[model samples]
Target chain A: MKAIGSFKGEPITDSDSLVDVEVPTPDLAEHDVLVEVKAVSVNPVDTKLRAGAPSQKEPLILGFDAVGIVVKTGSNTTKFSKGDRVWYSGTTKRPGSNEAYQAVDERLVAKAPRSLTDEAAAAMPLTSITAYELLFEKMGANFGQLANPGKTLLIVNGAGGVGSVLSQLAKWAGFTVIATASPANFDWLRANGVDQPIDYHDDLETQVQGLGHHFVDAAVILYDVPSYYDAVTKLVAPGGHIGAIVGTQAKLNMEQLKSKSLSLDWEYMFAKGDFDFRMETQGEALRQIAQLVDNNFVHTTLSRTIDSGLNAKNLREAHQVVEEGHVVGKVVVSGPFNGQVNE
Target chain B: MKAIGSFKGEPITDSDSLVDVEVPTPDLAEHDVLVEVKAVSVNPVDTKLRAGAPSQKEPLILGFDAVGIVVKTGSNTTKFSKGDRVWYSGTTKRPGSNEAYQAVDERLVAKAPRSLTDEAAAAMPLTSITAYELLFEKMGANFGQLANPGKTLLIVNGAGGVGSVLSQLAKWAGFTVIATASPANFDWLRANGVDQPIDYHDDLETQVQGLGHHFVDAAVILYDVPSYYDAVTKLVAPGGHIGAIVGTQAKLNMEQLKSKSLSLDWEYMFAKGDFDFRMETQGEALRQIAQLVDNNFVHTTLSRTIDSGLNAKNLREAHQVVEEGHVVGKVVVSGPFNGQVNE
Candidate 1:
């Protein structure tokens, strides 16, 4: 099987940063489903892993989001069968979805949205799962339930991949969505379901307050938590929740939340897969997200797609575009494997 | 009205630390219930407030937990009448319950347990509400539901005020309760529904693992967070919750919880009163707790009662006992107001 991988933690500018390699096909575990990956998306996790991950003896495949067709299944697999089209953000502890053929836990795999293409489907799993979990699990929003009609959500970096989907999900869950994005992406943010799009460069507290909202019922930060910590703390209403995906370099002053009875939660989408805790919920979430996407409640956040096909060269280019940090939404490498085959 | 209060932050040993004074009777708000306090409990909050609260022109009355008879009611009050027996952990924002009379919001007060004395019922509201919210609201435990039979909880300082009630609440909610305290308090902990009581001075991880649990579903720290953080993090199961009442002075290394996707929540019982967010829920929780107490599912954590009554000297002595920090459970002041009446 041919895969795009990196052996050393190096900048994307280095030719060896991500290169094509032939590796043996992965063996299936009892709950595994072998997927012939058709498309994969590049995320901040890929760039971060490529730049700072310890050098491994074997090259580390670094894509978490993929859309694929099931090629084989383990003897004990129950949810999926061969020939099924699936989408998932696979585990971080195992080899990722950047390879031609990868074995993923059946519990994390879900049928892709029938209304979307493989590239569009691939763009969603990671960010959609992240957004779903961030809203429902971490922040205590009811799953697909409109129980909180007047509630408000403040999404930081609302034009990004996770935020684009998150804005839609928040709106679906009955939150009046307020988001922060660059002026260039304001229209896109509004189109994605944000009721108000404030420029991230402006004073966030002032901007949020200007909308006649004293504080938001919940706040989700998709980017640097430390830089947005004070703003989030100030913007979150009493008994509100603040969730983040990224880890902070410095220690957080947790006492700031004590007075407001605010809750601070970290939503790492890979935690379930990494710890083997409630992995089935990931599949359930993806299934629900696919339904929403098919129903047109959520649109694909695939802003850029490399239609030339999946190869080390194209994946590297996708990684470069993601590394630049100005991409509006997701960047995916689509179509069948074009690299040299090993088996 | 006669009240025991402090004009300056001073040691309990100081003569004027908590002195008897005459203050004007409180004017009731539309939703206020004026209670003739019969008994009040001294918690760590009282001692802390006495030691460092800023001096006020009028002395600050610092008791939060109280059981009293409603003497008067405001026009808009619906929950209580003029002759009802009520118990509440009143707000910190107003003059607390350490006086002859207190005007508290009707929404924050609930009927006292029918089976217990005023002193016994008084010992519960603060700790009970704290425990209830920490378990249910902050840590995601289902309120009044036995939804988690196999789940386990680790209660740090199980013999303390909040911990004593929390252990029972966790047990009632179907969690297998594990707690840490001195060996002397182990029997008390067991009586309070702790399934396994480990010595706090010994190795906590080793003690917990010896009980055949590698991790707990949840952990609550009634004392210092930073001191128990590492142990709590290691002992918490994947996707578990860790809650605390006390704030840390130093910055916390929150990244330690990232791998397991654990949440760290701070439970401040006064938050509802301070921020005016969902004060009704406090009353609802108290009403539920009172029913639990009356039904014998939970018991008052009152270990000591100052029968000498509510006065400056007895309150100061109670404050001294709390400041010493070795008491097994709550210390409370019972009986009539002995100071000179203002009216």
Candidate 2:
């Protein structure tokens, strides 16, 4: 099977950053599904791993978000069959979906949205799973029931992929969404169901206060850890919830949250996948997410798509595009050598 | 009205640290109650105020936990009548309850427990208010519902005034309580209803893990911030909640909470009184707590009581006891006289 992997940290611009190699496939367990990868999206985790993959005996496969078809199913796998379209964010500790044929636990895979294209569906899994878990699972949003109708959620860095989807989902769950985006994306954010889109460049505390809301019921941070920590802390109401997706190096004086009795939480969506806990819930969440997309309640964040066959050159270019840091949504490498997009 | 106050920060050993001074009677508002203070408990807050009290135009009166009788009630006050026995933790911004007569908002006052003596009642208000809010209000422990029966709560520093009361309340609320205390206080901690009293002198994580509670549902921390932060991060269950009453000058790396999706909260119970939020709830909680005490579901932690007359010398001695930090539970100063423990 053809795979894209790295042995050690390297700059994305270097030729050896991500290499195309052949790796032998392993025997499948009773709960595994072998997927023939058709399309995959590059996320920040891809770049992070590319630059930080540990030096080990085996090469580290790099992609997490992929849309593919079940080519083989284990005897115990009942949810999927051969030729079933699926989308998933695979586990971090195992071989990722960068390979042409990747064997994964059936529990992590979900039926892809039939109404959307493979590229669009590929972009949804990792970010959507993270946003969904952070809002509904960890923060106790309760998607099965209507969230507080007038409750406000402040989404920091609202134009990013996860924040974009989270805004729509929070709105879908009945919350009045307040998102922070750049000046250029204000109209785009409001168009995508955000009730109010504030400029991330301004003083967020002042802006939130000026909105006549003394504090937001909850806040989700998608980017800008050090700069936005205080702003989020100041904006949350008494006993309000705050979840940060990214990791930080410094200790953040949690005492800041004491006055309001604010709850500080961290959401790393891959933990359950890595630790093997209720892994089937990921598939269930993805299935529900697909329905939401099909019903037009949520939209994909595919900014652009390229076709160059699943190889090293195509992967490097995709990494370069994402590394530029101004992606409107997502960039996907798809197709079996489509002539123009590849050229 | 005669009161103990200080115009500036000074050592408790200094004769002028807390002086008896006569000030004009406070004017009563529509919902205010004029109480003749009968007894007062000296908490860390009193010492804190004596050292950190703001230099104001008028002298800053000190003391928070107080038990008294309502001498007068203003118009629109319906909760209590003249001669009603009450206890309260005074508002942070207002003149405190350590005086011959103190005017307090009726919402901050609750009927004292009929079964408790004045000293015992005074020892409860501040600690009870803090513990109740930390458990029910901050961490959302449902005292009204037995939803998470047999759930574990790790209370750090459980032999202190607030911890002693909190351990019993957690037990009453159907949680299996694990408390951390010094070796000397182990039996006392167990006697206070803690199922397990681990020594906080060693690694708290290992000690708790040895007891078979690898992770806890919630935690209430009273002291030792730097040592406990890492242990709390490790011992808190995934999606568990932690609340603390201590202040920290050092920054905390909140990313530690990301993997398990833990919640880190700080419970400043005075916030409600300081910010004037749901003030009536404090009185209501105190009233319910009084009932719990009357029913013997809880007990006061008045370790030592001084019939110290309302004067500078006696108040200074009470402050000294709290400052020494060896006193268990509460040290209260009571009665009225010409600057002596006995009238």
The top-ranked prediction according to DockQ is 1
How many backbone overlaps does candidate 2 show? 3
Q: For model 2, how does the per-residue alpha-carbon lDDT over A1-343 read when each residue is reduced to its tens digit?
A: 5677887878989988888777777568899998888899999989988887777657788788899988888878888989999999988878888887788888988899999999999888988988888888766575843456768899998888898888888889988889998989987788667888999889898888898888788998888677788888877776677888888887676677777667776777777675565688888889999999999899998888887587778988899988888887888988752222110
* Model 1: per-residue Cα lDDT over B251-298, one tens digit each: 777677766767777788888888777899999999999999989999
lDDT of 2: 0.83
Regions of candidate 1 where Cα sits further than 4 Å from its true position: A54-57, A339-343, B339-343
Per-residue lDDT tens digits for candidate 1, residues A305-338, read 9988787788889999998999998999987776
Worst 10 residues of 1 chain B by lDDT: B334-343
Q: How many pairs of residues collide in model 1?
A: 0
Across residues B1-343, which tens digit of lDDT does each residue of candidate 2 receive?
A: 6788898888889887788877877879999999888899898988987887666657788789999999899988999999999999878788897778888999988999999999999999999988988887767677753445968999999999899999878888888999988889988898777999999788888889999986788887789666688889878776677788888887776677777667776777777776666789889989989988998889998988888576788888889999999887998889873533210
Candidate 1, lDDT over the whole model: 0.89
Residue B90 of model 1, lDDT score = 89
